[model samples]
Target: MSDTFDPDHLRAELLPLSTLQAPSEEAQAYQRFYGLNALGPNGATSSRIGRVEVGGYDIVTQLWVPDQPVGTLVLMHGFYDHVGLYRHVIDWALGLGLAVIACDLPGHG
Candidate 1:
C-alpha cells in the first residue's frame, strides 16, 4: 500500500482570506485574520456550532438543541463539497429533533 500524505503543510499554504468582490460592490468578501468563518447565522443555529480541529483541519460541528435533548447527528459530505450545500438536510434534521454537524473539507467549495 502507498503512504498517506500529510495535509497540514498544504492547509497552511491556502491564504486565510479571498479578495473576491460581491454583488457589484454592494457587498464585500468576508475577511478573517486568525481562523475561518463557519459561514452561518447567529442565534439558535450559531449557538450549536462548535470548532473542531481534527487531522490538522478545522471542522464545524453544529448541534441542534432540542426541547428534550435526544442524541447527536453527524453528517459527512463527499469530495469537493461544502457543509453549506446541506441546508435543506440540516433543516430536516431540526424538524426531526436531532442535532446536525457538518464541515467544509480542504480544497472543497
Candidate 2:
C-alpha cells in the first residue's frame, strides 16, 4: 500500500490527561482484561502501569518483573496493536525469569 498520512497532527490534537474524562464501562472492562487495574498478589514479583510524556502526548507504559530476573525484555507492539495481545509472551518470559517492559503506542490500545 502507498499512502501519505500525518500522525503528528493527531498527536498534537490529543488532550492533556488532566482534561480528559473518566473511562467508560467498556474501557474499564478492557482494562481489566489487560490487567491494567493493579498487580495481583499471586503473580510476577512486581508490575506497574503508568504514562510517559512523548512529544506532547501521553503514552501508556507497563512493567513486569520476576522475583529473580535474569534480564530485561522490552516488549514492543506493532501498528494497531497493544500489550494486551501479548499476555502469553509475558507469562513465558516471566516463567524464564525475564523482566518485561511494554507500552501502548500513540493512537493505539
Candidate 3:
C-alpha cells in the first residue's frame, strides 16, 4: 500500500475504476481508509460495476442489492467525490434491505 493517501493510489484497483486490476494491497488500503469492510457493512447479496450512458455521457456505475431489498437508494456523493467514497452509505442501505445504485458524476469519479 502507499505510505500516503494518494488519490492515484486509490484509483484503478478494480472494475469501474480501471480496465486493469491492481494489487490487493492497494485495494485494501482504499477500503481501510474509508473504514469499509471493517468500520461498516461490506457484504452484499449482489454487486455489479459497469458503465451507462447518462444525458449523452458515459458514466461509471455500481449497484448493490441485499437478499430482499424493500426499496432502492440512489446515492450521490459530494462535490469532487466518486461512487467509491460512499460504500458506507451503500452498505447501510443494503443492511436495511434496500438496493443501492451510485455513479460517478460526469467528468468526475
Q: Identify the candidate with maximal lDDT.
A: 2
Tens-digit lDDT string for candidate 1 (1-109): 1123223442333332222212111111111111122322332332233345668866544344445435666778898776556766765665566655555655553
Instruction: List CA RMSD, all candidates.
Output: 12.2, 9.1, 4.7
Q: Candidate 3 residues 1-109, lDDT tens each? A: 5533454444443445234333356555544565443321455455554556668866666566777779999988878887667766776777788877877787676
Model 2, residue 14: C-alpha shift (Å): 15
What's the lDDT for candidate 2? 0.64
For residues 1-109, what per-residue lDDT tens digits would candidate 2 score against the true structure?
Answer: 1122233442344443334345434444544676543332356456555566888868866677778788988998998888888887777777788888887888786
Q: lDDT (CA) for every model shown?
A: 0.43, 0.64, 0.61
**Clash count per candidate:** 0, 0, 0
TM-score of each: 0.50, 0.64, 0.62
Ranking by lDDT: 2, 3, 1
Cα-based lDDT at residue 20, candidate 2: 38
Candidates, ranked, TM-score: 2, 3, 1
